[model samples]
Target chain A: MSEFWSDYTVRVVVFGSALIGAVSGALGCYAYLRRQSLIGDVVAHSSLLGIVSAFWGAFLLTGSGNKSLWVIIPGAIVAGLAALLLTRAVTGLTRIKEDAGLGVMLAIFFGTGMMLLRWLQRAQPPIPGRSSLDGYLFGMSAAMTSQDLWMIGLIGAAAVITMLLFWSRLKILTFDPEYAAGLGLPVRRLELLLLCLMVIGIVVGLQIAGVVLMISLLVAPAAAARQWTHHLGKMVGLASTIGAICAAGGALLSAVFSHLPTGPVIVALVTLAFVASVLCSPSRGLLFRRRFVVD
Target chain B: MDIAIETQQLTVAYGAQPALWNVNVEIPSLGITGIIGPNGAGKSTLLKAILGNVPRLSGHVTLHRTDEAGSAAIGYVPQRSAVDWDFPTTVFDLVMMGTYGRLRWFQRPGKREREQTRQALQQVHMEEFADRQIGELSGGQQQRVFLARAFVQRASIYLMDEPFAGVDAKTENMLIEILHQLRDEGNTIVLVHHDLTTVKDYFDHVVLLNRKLVACGTTPQTFTAENIELAYGVAGKQLLSRIS
Candidate 1:
């Protein structure tokens, strides 16, 4: 408890978490628009397998417990992309509902990951110098170093630039893909680019926010922001701001008070923001619920 | 004198089910063309195929130039139910989206685009409701907003699907008036119409269809009882009997 309050680590944790949130928030807008909100949930859960696989792969190849962030980053991203492609293929080939497709993909991947993780745990003795990777499961911003913060910040900035470049086409495709294609927009290419972006955001955020809570970061803020505005640009901006605020606030609070899992704390903060939006947002919000009801 | 849209043996299918059969049709460059048919008779499918929103099984759609002046642009307005109305956007914002194709990628909507959106809204008489959330609009208003969107496209050819469904008589008349104005301006307009009574009154050309093209020409020539019966099926026959 004393160690938590006495450090400058709080600043790193909060700043890093906020950046993670902003990235997810921006990407989540597209996910929600494509009517693929639940797909985010599936992707988030599936990344645990990616992380575990990356961990074991690193362990086997390097025999180095110090952990190579470079190796894990690419490994995790590739694995996550594979899972996404598999999900899309299953949905296209079978009569399975999307929800069922997501469920099946999540279960199979996560199960294999758990098996690999257990095998790794039993086969290799604990490295005396290296800390356990369990911190990633729930996220501990206190354990994150400057390198982790740099990774999050760099990825977040890249995502923002991509969004700015293709905002118009992305908005059109998200709103009405059929209409967009009719207008001769590159609908297929744009969608594929968007999917690639989502995978990148999820893979990066999984490090600091953890997969379990990353979906909330991606979806909750955007959904909440939706209640506040009618413009897509404004919604994306507001959602990113709300997500960043929640992430920063959650990380700050958790740092100030020890024994808090940064992931769930950030999610709770985001949930609070969602409730506030529902209660207070101006046009068409849930709080204005009384106005729309007519006899 | 020119053909606006000329399809040579146009055919469209959905999976294994055929929605539209090989159909050759030539359309005039101006005036309202009422496309009437029974359910699953490829009324909407024909428009989708023309718009390239749906895949064409086989055919070529050639947009001819009027005396080498250059071909006209094609615009489409899908059914109101085809999209989620609750999507986060203002009526003005949605209408402005019609100009995306004309604007460059990085550039935002400028004053010119905004003015076009406003004028389009005014055309539909929805100028007062420009700032309204799309979900807040009634079915009729929503349909008008979409019409306004297509109007902003400002293309020479317009293809609309079920613009009259769920609309009030006033809204319907408003739409008809706009269509008339566009026709008078020499823009070709094709409407997927449900009502048979208004074909002769509302449009100059008519396409009667049931899975395949039954008849296509001027209202007097193609809207005959025999063609209407074939287009509408038994229900159309019963209705024709009642009308007579």
Candidate 2:
């Protein structure tokens, strides 16, 4: 226990995980508001293809796999946006519903990622010292360094700023898109901007929450927070706090154990919070409903 | 004396079916213009077409000056069922959203915006329910909250669709009073209305539509039994006679 406090790597892991959780929480509120909560999973899963493509592309072009974070981040964001546009186009052009569009996008993207993974395995190995991309597939909290912590913190701040800057427009657009447009709001522009931000957050979160469970961090905290409040600002704040606790607790537990996967543990903690919130929240919660007058 | 909305051979359709065709009409400012017709008579379609919510197949809609000063500001209050009411938002927050058009990016709502929201809530007699969740309110209260949101837009021209539909008697009366107030303040208010019983008593200007303009003028002039017959078919005459 004493050595755990002294270990610099443990500190970085804990801090990075917590910051990533907070960012996901903030972005999740908008996702839930848009009623596309599960789309976060779609965005996260689609990034795996981005990762492998960037790795292989960098190796083929420059004979290196240890590509800069800048290269990988932009590649992931472009792929994510392409997937979003493709899903939307399919839904609008066809009779398929939004949920079905999301499902198709998720499956097709994940399958493509698997194909890319197999191709990466077959290809000749590039320059050494570049780690396998598994850290993003399933987060490696123990391997987090000071640099990763700083990066996560910067991304978290940007996410928070995005939420605050467009809070009013987002609220109007989500609640009533037609009326918002009637009032001269650039509804389409605002919606596109928000979707862009969502992609950025999902791509960055891959480092700490991993591709598979990153979306759980985005949705579970916001869904849990929804059980407690109807006010948007309060819901966003509550979600961020809940997510931070889950991430921190998961990181601490993983620090104690030698080989436990931090991603699943963090997701499990978030799921537990959601269950508790569902049972204890004021209006919709099972227990609290007994106190309110039934209409 | 001033025209607020004018259409030139306006045609609207949804997929293969036509909702409104060659509907030419001129709406006056500074009064409540009631648009009443039978089901599928393109009442709501007319409103949507004018606001550009629905795509127009042909013709043009020219929106003139809202008031004597000629400001082009417009406001809209859609039907309650058009949106997901369970959205995570409070009455105050939703009303404050009306100020988003005026504020610059990255700036939060200041004290003036909050005060305007409060005043709008008071206008609709919803000040007491400002902090409540929108979903927790009754049907009438929810309508009033939406009205409050529209009021906060503070535009000189307002377009509303079925604001009194499914509301209680008190809510209906309250809406009439607010519309009259807005009209007296020199704002043009157009409503997609039903219930012919109160048309003459509540509204001054009227537009009788049946996929085409049947009549347009004061309620006594355009809402006659013949125009009602033309717009609503023979069965509508009996329905209007009972109420009239």
Best candidate, TM-score-wise?
2
Model 1 chain B TM at 0.94
User: Candidate 1: where is the Cα deviation over 4 Å?
Assistant: A1-6, A65-69, A125-131, A282-288, A293-295, B8-11, B65-73, B242-244
Residue pairs of candidate 2 with colliding backbone atoms: none
Every model's TM-score:
0.90, 0.90
Q: What would the per-residue lDDT of candidate 2 be over residues A1-295, giving only the tens digit for each residue?
A: 8887788888777887788778888788878778776777888888777877887788778776754455566667777777778998997777788889988888888779868877666656534434556767776677666765666677668867877878778778878888887777777898887887677667766766788888888889999999988878889899988888898788878878867788888989999999999998877998777643412
Error of 1 at B149 (Å): 1.7
Worst 10 residues of 1 chain B by lDDT: B65-74
Best by lDDT: 2
lDDT of 1 by residue, A99-188 (tens): 787888878876776676666666647742234566556666676677777776776788779888988788878888777766667788
Structural RMSD, model 1: 3.1
Worst 10 residues of 2 chain B by lDDT: B65-74
